[model samples]
Target: MISINNLSYYIGDRPLYDDASLFIGPKDRIGLIGLNGTGKSTLLKMITGEDQPTAGEINMSNDTTIGFLNQDLLSYLTDDSILHVAMQAFAETMKIQKQIDEVLHEMETNYRDELVDKLAKLQERFETNDGYTMQAKAEEILEGIGFSTQDLQRPLKEFSGGWRMRVMLAKLLLEKPSLLMLDEPTNHLDLPSIQWLENYLQSYDGACIIVSHDRRFLNASINKIVEVSAYQLNMYAGNYDFYLEEKELRNEIQQNAFENQQQKIRQAERFVERFKAKASKAKQAQSRAKMLDKMERIEAVADEAAAVDFKFKFKVKSGRHVVKMENISKSYGDLNILSHANAHIERGDKIAFIGANGKGKSTALRIVAETESFQGTLQKGHNVTTAFYAQHQLEALNIQNEILEELKQAGSGKTDQELRGVLGCFLFTDDEVFKKIKVLSGGEKSRVALAKTLITESNFLMLDEPTNHLDMMSVSILVQALQQFEGTFLLVSHDRDFISKVANKIWWIEDHEIKEYPGTYEEWEWWYNREQEKKKSSPQPQNSEKKEKAKVAVEKPRHDDTQKQLEKEIAQLEGKIEALESEVTKLETELSKPEVFGDAAKMEKTTNRYQSKKAELETLNATWEQLVEKIG
Candidate 1:
């Protein structure tokens, strides 16, 4: 749907992209990736016409529409309900409905056939656009992206920036533009919302280009990978994992070619120098030199991955118990977070706190760190020293200090040489260490803060979302560092891959209590999914009698006659359930057809049939389960 040809963008004298080209098809799902400072976000802006490229052009079909979700949308504020804001995607449908309302009002006063006919036309147009279902569609998208039903009616201006960003995301998804572009979309989303978005994008009808640092999100959602590096756009046909393998193979082949070309050039130069001095074969030497000059050159591959060789050591080892919390109760206004919650961390434990937003993950972290006020008893282990790192901590770094100076101020008592080595592990090379903190980008500042946190002598660490603004390589380095660290740590992160790699225990908040699963994230995921399936299979009881009946059905054995009857009933229920499911599917297809929706009578009849069939299917499935239980 969109084509970028020979695109070149420059920031002053530095060329971020040169001779870059990419074609976005109608069904493309692209993951744009590169190291920080490689101009990923800038490319999105250029595509959306927010910024013009220094050269070349971007072209799209005349009818194509664009939807861009960027960080700037976080600042959007409005007093309208979130549902209303999302429903604004159907601007034409809403306008048509308004006109229909006006025509009906006029008919009530004038009692004219002309007004009735105009109203008929307007209502037809509204039905043709499926205006009646727009509100439900908006609500579904808002809830899918993590808004509560109650929050849907709340003013958009009342929410925080992150929440506001989710509202904007819902609006964009509802709009369903031809080309969708997102920049670091997962930054504001929790794990559940991220998974929800992944599922949505998997079935998204339009073309999408996503720039995100979360490796697992990219691998799950995107089919193609585009790397912005070395002043060019390099395309990979498959996902991020495939891109890694393919890029490695390509780099190896390129490296070999470059080496062979260098060898030939060296031989030619040596021949020219030796033979040209004697003038015996100077013509041949000159010809060889000219041929060498005209030959196409192969560029050597750049090593982008950083080696994380820095080791973390504590000044003093803590006791077996790193921290102990008991009877923890926290509240903000009338909103209760944790009540009488208990949790403990051991000296060697690595824990990950994860869940949807507004689940008190960050509150629990703050409580553990003892930085927030709570009605709780928290005890630190003997000789334990703690260091807490958060996004807000990024602001705590002295802007006047250079990167090396900041590390020295961390009080690790390390020399400048040792600190420089530590900075190199975080990808700060040569004179980059001399750059002031104020001039650094968000990612660069994050790396500097993380380096300081690692070099500290604390025996325990509390890192909240440390992987934000980090590239895949940087995240890998941080993972390696955490793996080798000797201290205990508890982290709150939405990155599932990061959690799975670093965490030996899983922590989550449920029913205003801290819940722990003493296993790896992968194990916890399996167990959690099984529990959810069990819940889905077992419906909640309306009263004690129904609950008791269900229990009796499961516990009691049946006589031969009763067993046969139960089996017969179960078979009948299953047949009915299958028929109802098929009916529901057919009704849904009918509802989606233009001929049905464009007429009010047909649309209402199809929708009512769809709902009735769905309800019938649910009851039949329930009956079949009860019959099977009785027989078993």
Candidate 2:
């Protein structure tokens, strides 16, 4: 649909892209992967023509349509309600509809021939475009991105920046152009909403180029990976996992080739050195020298590894019960945030606290961290040490201190060398570490907060939106470090992909109630779907004697043949239910155990099977109930 030819772009003195060319075809779903400040978003802007490249051109067919969702541009349109803003994607259809209405009115009043002709043409256009279904399409796109039906009517100005971006996403999806470009589309979405988006994008027919740090989303949604590295663009014809393996293989091959070339050059040089004055072999040595001179030297690509090695050194172990809360009720006037909530975190539990925005996730984190209080029994486990990193922890940095000093004060017990290494891992290397905290950008400050958090030797870590300002590479590094850490983690994150990778248990807070599901995020989703299906299929309880109305009247009871038959059927169903239940239980038990849940594929398969069995058991139980009632 679009072709980028010899595209080179720069920012000031930095070259973002060099001779980068890519072709986006129909049905091509691509994940644009890169490190922080590698110009992923800038490249998208150039592709969409919102930003011009420093050199080269982007060619597109005249009829091709493109929709680009820019995070920064969402604040421009604030007067309209969220629904009205999103519905603007159908403005052309709406205009055509209005024109058709005017023509019909004119024809009805005066029976003008021209009006009738125009009306017929307009009707044809509307039908051809499926203009009648525009509103439904818009609603579907909006709802899929987690916008509540009621939220559509609210003014866009009332919503926070995150929600405004969702409104933008809805509009972009509703437009359904030939090419769809999304930058961090899942940034504000909850787990359910992210899943919904994944399913939607998986089935999206048009071409899409998404710049997102959500690894699981990329692995599940994209068919290709486009990596921007070292002022060049590299294409891998598969998803993120495929890209990883392919990139590694390619690097290994290149390394081996480079090694072989270097060895050949060395041998040739040695021959030339040893036979410089030899009479018989002089010509051969000279030939070898010439060959060595002409040979093109191959250099191995630089090894890219996360600079920081995060190793948690705990000074004190947490008590058996890490944290305890009871009868917790928090409210803002009449709006109850949480009520009668009780929770306990053990010594070695990795808990993911999740919910939609403003559902008391942060509030709960604050309460547990003792930064805030509610009317409840909140107890810290004996010898419990806590290091809490709030979403806005970066704002608390000392402006006077440089990045290095700020990290030093965090007192992670690391030597100067180790502290510098940690700072380098966060991209604050060399003179960057000497920059004052106040001079740093928001993302840099966030990195500083992360570094400072790592310095604390607390057994229990409570991190709120730690990945918010991080780039894809930084986020991956953090995820890896957290996965390897031995300390307990209670994280509040909207990043579904991150949660899926790190969290063993999900504590879902919804509608002032919290439910704990012992599995990965995908498993939680499967279980939720099965529960919804059960609700939809379950029958309402019947009143007493309801079964008697359907029973056939019998003389002398006939040795209770109907009852015996029903009993036999019930027994058979019970047996099936027992077997299914056992399978589900076994899977759940395995998933609940920490060791088994670490294997991503195994965990997913086990969880999927568990969900299927649970659904089957529900069906069998319903059938058994029906049979028992019929027999009665």
Candidate 3:
């Protein structure tokens, strides 16, 4: 639907993108990925017209619409209910409904034929726009994105920034634009909400461009991967995992070609050097030099992945019981976060706290860190020094200090060289270590904070949403660091891939109590899905005698006259169904024709007819089944 041709954007002397061309199809699900500072989000802004490209052009059809969900929406707040905000997506439908209402009111006074016709037209238009079901649609999307039914009517300003982002997401999804653009959407979402978004995008009709660091989310939701590298947009025909494998193969092939080209260039240069001085081979040497000058050199492959040689180090080994809590009861006036919850963390135990938003995952993490007060019997094991890392910690960093200086204050007692090595693992190297924290972006600040957190010689770590604002490579590095650490840690994060790799236990809050699944995230996911399936498959309990009475009350008696009438009705419905089925088949055939399908009006008309006939056929079939059951 949209085409970006030779797109280029520059900041001062730095070119973020140069001659980056990409085509977004009508139904493409594109995952835009790259390392930090790669201009993925900038591309989205350029498409949305929020940012002007330095060169090249972006073109889209006149009818194309866009819905963008970005971090900026987190600050959007108003007194309107979330449901009202979401329903705002159907502005045209709402306007039409208002016109219909006005027309009906005028008809009540005048009672004229013209008014009746106007009302009929308005109603037809409203139905075509699905105006009657707009509220339901908004509610479903809002709930699916983690808003509870009770919270739907709450003012948007009452929710936190993250929850507010969810409301914006719901509104955008409800808008159903022709091209949907989301930048790091999963960063604010919880696990269940992320899964819901994944399923929704799988069935989404429009084209989508999602820029995210969540690998699992990308793999589940997108069919194509576009990598922004070396100021160019490289298209991959498959998902993130496929891109990895394909890129590796392409890199290998390119490396081999580059090596061969280098070898040939060396041989030509050597031949020229040796034969240029000789009379017999002078012309040949000149020809070989021209060939060497004209040959296009192949660029070497640039590997995106980074290897981290540094691991988290702690001075003390904690006791077997790292942390223990009993009968924890905490509440905020009307909101009960935890009540009589009991859980414990053992030495070397890696736990992931996961659930939907508005749950007490962060609260539980704070309780573990002893930063939040509660009525509970909590105990910290011997030598269990604690270090807590959170998004807010990014603000705690001294803006005047350089990146290396920030690490020095962490007090791990590591040398400057050791700290530099740690910073390198986090993607900072050479002169980057001397860059002041004030010049760093949010993602860079997050890396710095994370580095500081890890360098602390604490046996117990409490990390809340550590993966937020981190790129996939950084997440992988943190995963590796955590895996190699000897400390006991409890973390709250929505990144499933990160959790699956680092966590050995799963924790969630249920009924205002802490719940534990003593297995990896993958295992807990399987068990949880099975449990949900069982709940869906298991029928509601009913007293057999009462159920039979209720059935008899609703069912018609199979009298002789009724049976004859039902059989006759069934036969008539069968004939109608057969005739309608033939009509539907003919419509389908016409719809497939080039003349019919090529014209928009004709295609829409034919599709409407086909759907109308199909619905009629289904109704007849259902009636036929009911009649047959009555006769039996």
Clashes of 2: 1
Count clashes in each candidate, considering only residues at least 3 apart in sequence or on different chains: 0, 1, 0
Go through the candidates in order and give each one's C-alpha lDDT. 0.87, 0.80, 0.87
Which candidate's TM-score is highest? 1
TM-score of each predicted structure versus truth: 0.88, 0.79, 0.85
lDDT of 3: 0.87
Clashes of 3: 0
Task: Summarize candidate 1's per-residue lDDT along 1-632 as a digit string, tens digits.
Answer: 78999999999999999989999999999999988899998999998899999999999999899999988887789899988889889999999999988887777779888888888888889989878777867876788789989999999999998888888898898888988898888998999889878877877778999999898999999999999989999999999999999999999999999999999999999999889767779899899889888999999888887887867778999999988999999999999999999999998899999999998999999989988999979999999998999999899999999999999999999989889999998989999999999999888889999988989989899999999988777888899889998889999999998999999999999999999999999999999999987964563343234335545564566567776677566556655665675677568667545466434466566766777788877787677666756565
Question: Could you give the C-alpha RMSD of every candidate to the true structure, in order shown?
Answer: 6.3, 9.7, 8.3
- Give residue 3's error in model 1 in angstroms: 1.6
Lowest summed lDDT over 10 consecutive residues: which window, candidate 3?
540-549
Misplaced by over 4 Å in model 1 are: 547-632
Q: What stretches of model 3 exceed 4 Å from their correct place?
A: 104-114, 537-632
Ranking by lDDT: 1, 3, 2
